[model samples]
Target: MSDSTTSIKTFRYRLYPTRAQEAAMFETLRLTRTLYNAGLEQRREAYRKHGKTLSAYDQQKELTALKEACLEFSGVYSHVLQDVFDRLDKAYKAFFSRVKKGAKRAGFPRFKPATRWDSFKFKQCWNNAKNDWTACGKPVDDGRRISIPKIGNVKIKLHRPLEGKPKSLQIVLDVDQWYAVYTCEVPVQPLPTTGSSVGIDLGTTWFAVTSDGEFIENPRHLGRSLGKLRVQQRTVSRRKKGGNRRKKAVKQVAKTYRKVRRQRLDFQHKTARRLIHEHDLIAHENLQVGNMAQSNLARSILDAGWAGFLFQLAAKAESAGRRVIAVDPRYTSQRCHACGHTGKENRVNQASFRCVQCGHTANADHNAAKNILDRGTSTERGEPLGRAVPSGENGSGVSHAVA
Candidate 1:
């Protein structure tokens, strides 16, 4: 693919490694975690004692000394070891960025225990021309196996054919399972235009409410699995700490949570795909999900996963040559769609919107979606942000199509 038309996309697959390879992977994970923690400590101490900041390169240069001092460090791939420091640097950069924005919680980088350090990246691995994996064993071109340095060829279950050139590989450890995530540079092709447009209202009660009054109900995967999760967690609590039984129980709990996460992710992807397939332009509120999650309905807000859904929507839309706009969310719920009267009384309940001034009533979420649609239309047309048409002003009733 030409550079202008190419985009990067990731595809993940399950990896089945032998017992020895699994042991090696665990050792590598432990060492990587140690390296990350050490890098974090060095940065913290340097700044505290001398008011000096260390770049990733500065810490990376010390890797040779680290390997010389610790035999375990030498066993890990050099690039993989370097990536640990890179991860730390990125975390520190993000923390400072948040601090500059006056965030209440500018999270400091913390040490990662073995359980928390789950993934490592390999920027270059597969060499297609040579039919070899760099610095590792060769991989069969049939997509059945992939070789890794310090580990032998691992079995791969190919669910789909890989397209384009593989650019990077990420080895992920989820609970007790292993996965290889491949990012490839592929050609981006625009889909045929349908000239359709829509605005969406996301909520905990409803997954998505479109401007056309279509409601997608939220699937509370986590809530539904909470009972079983509690049972598994209780089993863990009952077992003696550091015992095999406790470890097994812990894995069970993690597996349950992971299942919930996968279910949520699958739903989000399918929902986003359907929206992008039907509409050429999509609009949604640019919500501060983090701040919203800090409210009284924190659990519900987090479970909604609105941010992740929007992110998926944007990605799909980009690949499909569609536009997804985020409008200002202020007053969207309280503003009277029919009369343009903004009042707290406009939204009498969660589901009902009634304009006190003109006595116009409609589904609260639906009305908000319409206003969002109008704002999006204005934005698309390059009109002033303040311009929005009232519902009855032009005799365009509730049945009017979003486009």
Candidate 2:
């Protein structure tokens, strides 16, 4: 495959560091976080006192002197420390970009608390040579362990075989457990064409309904784990703050939530993979889920995770050489697919749909899926995207030409 590798994927592996190794990693974390906070304060102070913003490069150039002064900084790898400044630089740049766009929440970069800053990255892991990792970071001892600069070889559980060339490594802390996340570049392996297309209607009650009459069920991952979460939360409340017992209780609560998140993520990945494998062209509504969640049904809408599913579907489709099209969602639910009759009366209820003019009845989600398919096909035929044509006795609908 001469095509340039465009797909950048991430892989996570559970790490089992010895107590001493873990302590060293924690030291690295503390040093990097302190550096980040100090850099932020410098920028703010410079701007407030001199009306001049301190750029990342300006602070990065001062690293050598800071390391010489602070003996502890010399203990950590230089590249790892440098990454901290680079990350803060990105945060500041993003904040400014958002403010320029008049975003609602142009949040300034704030100092990260100990609990919030759970990860540290090494800027250079694998050298430019393919499959060759730098001495600072590499999978050694047959992938069972990884070498980190400050911390010695940490035992790792390589659950899945690593693919692609590793570019960087991130050490992450989830509650009390440690993980190594690898960023890699892999060439795409296109799947065989399926020669089929389908439109999907996503809902809270049901995960998805396809124009082909397949109904996908929603697992309600968070809803199912609510009981355990409630119990852990209650335990956390019973313990006094700052106590080791309370911290443990908090971790318990976080563990349950983590499991729920993983479950939801796994479900989305599998569903997206299946859709990509089955359909050459998959169509769905271009839903503004963020805006949709601003109402009373926010909990259900968020829990359904329609946005996550669509994102996964699109990404998988791209890698598989399939097409994913998003159609306008305006009247898909209310309009009658059978007669192209646009009216709210067509929606008998959430699950039922009936066209008054054509006397056509079907499941609401199924009808919407059909309408999405029609819209998507028209778009592929060079029709205006997101345009809904009204059709009735006046025959005001999109016309087709025979080949």
Candidate 3:
């Protein structure tokens, strides 16, 4: 094996800071949010009054004056403060780019409320030559504790071994918990080659149907927790505004949502791993899920989590040296895999499919999976990736070659 790094990945750990350290972390978030807003306001006023544009470098050059004006700003690391301006710059650039494209909603950057600003990042961390980490953040005492710039060493739960050199660190707050996420330049170890291939059909009623007749059932995690969420939401509404009771109720609702999100993510990761491990090449529809979710079946479509599943599948495939191909989804649902006949009437119902021309019948999703496989293989093998050709008299089953 060559001693070379292949990829970069992130590792997250739960942090348990002392009360004082917690206060310091919160202060860092608040100051960063304040700085972000101030920078945004300066740009807006500058543009409105003088018709001048302020670049990130211009704003960054004024950081010294800012620190002198506000004593609290000096407490945080200088690089961290620079990142706040960088974030605002990114937002403005995105806004202008969207406007140039004539987007309907050219989302202008808005002020972030205290509740929304939940994280701060340190851009630099590792030192390779000296084999030493910086003072702003470093793993302490064999990774059990981590030292922050303003805050002392905070206890950490190192769930997994850290790989590669740490590049940057982000301290995130979710609900009441603080997490330290480290992005690293890890070496990738690709799995052994698998000669297998499979095509998948994604649906709301079923999570996925493989070309080999494997049906992965949808868990409907969100639907299962929806009743509890309604109860928590009602509790929040009944509580008085700006009261501790209401805040607590709101947190409860957020916690429930987090639980459901976790469940869905867990399921997707596991399923993606299974497919990547078992197959050398995987194919699925290149669905426009965002557009699809705008219809009346939006709730059901979102609940299926097709986008997340596909993303996870792609990520895992990339890391494992596997192939994931997204084929056109045009007539996969209506086209008959047996005879190349295409018609809406072929879909007998949500679950069944019957070819009117050749009398071959199968599950609707299974037929779609087969067609997806054919499309993927045809494209991969340099053949015309088109609808299946009609075969024998009356358009009987047409055999197609695939590698």
Candidate 2's TM-score? 0.87
Which RMSD values do the candidates have, in order?
Answer: 4.5, 3.8, 4.2
Q: In terms of TM-score, which candidate is strongest? A: 1
Q: 1-403 in candidate 3: lDDT tens per residue?
A: 1133355667889999989999999999999999999999999999999999999889999999988998999999888889888889999998998798776677799999998899999888877678878875698888889988876799999999888778889999988899999987766668897778899999987999999999999989999999999999999999999999999999999898888888998999899999999988898999868667778989877888889999889877766667889998877888888877777778899999998878889999999999998888877777777854333354444433322
Q: Write the per-residue lDDT of candidate 2 for residues 162-261, one digit (tens) a residue.
A: 7777778999998789999987767777888877889999988799999998999997998999988998899999999999999999888889988987
Write candidate 1's Cα lDDT for 1-403 as tens digits: 3344776667888989999999988888888888898888999899999999999999989999989988878888888888888898899889899899887887778888777889887767667788655754235656688778877778888788766667777889999899988887777777788888999998877988999999999999999999999999899999999999999999899999999999999999999999999988899998978767878988887788888899899877766678899998877887777767766667789999998778999999989888888789888998877543334554433222232
Q: How close is candidate 1 to the true structure, as a TM-score?
A: 0.91
Worst ten in a row by lDDT for model 1: 394-403
Clashes of each: 0, 0, 0
Q: After aligning candidate 2 to the native by TM-score, how far in Å is the CA of 183 from where it should be?
A: 1.6
Clashing pairs in 1: none
- Higher-scoring candidate on lDDT, 1 or 3: 3
The C-alpha local distance difference test score for the whole of candidate 2 amounts to 0.84
Residue 82 miss distance in model 2 (angstroms):
3.1
Better of 2 and 3 by TM-score: 2
| Model 3 stretches astray by more than 4 angstroms | 1-5, 43-55, 89-106, 128-132, 381-403
For candidate 2, which ten residues in a row score worst on lDDT? Answer: 394-403
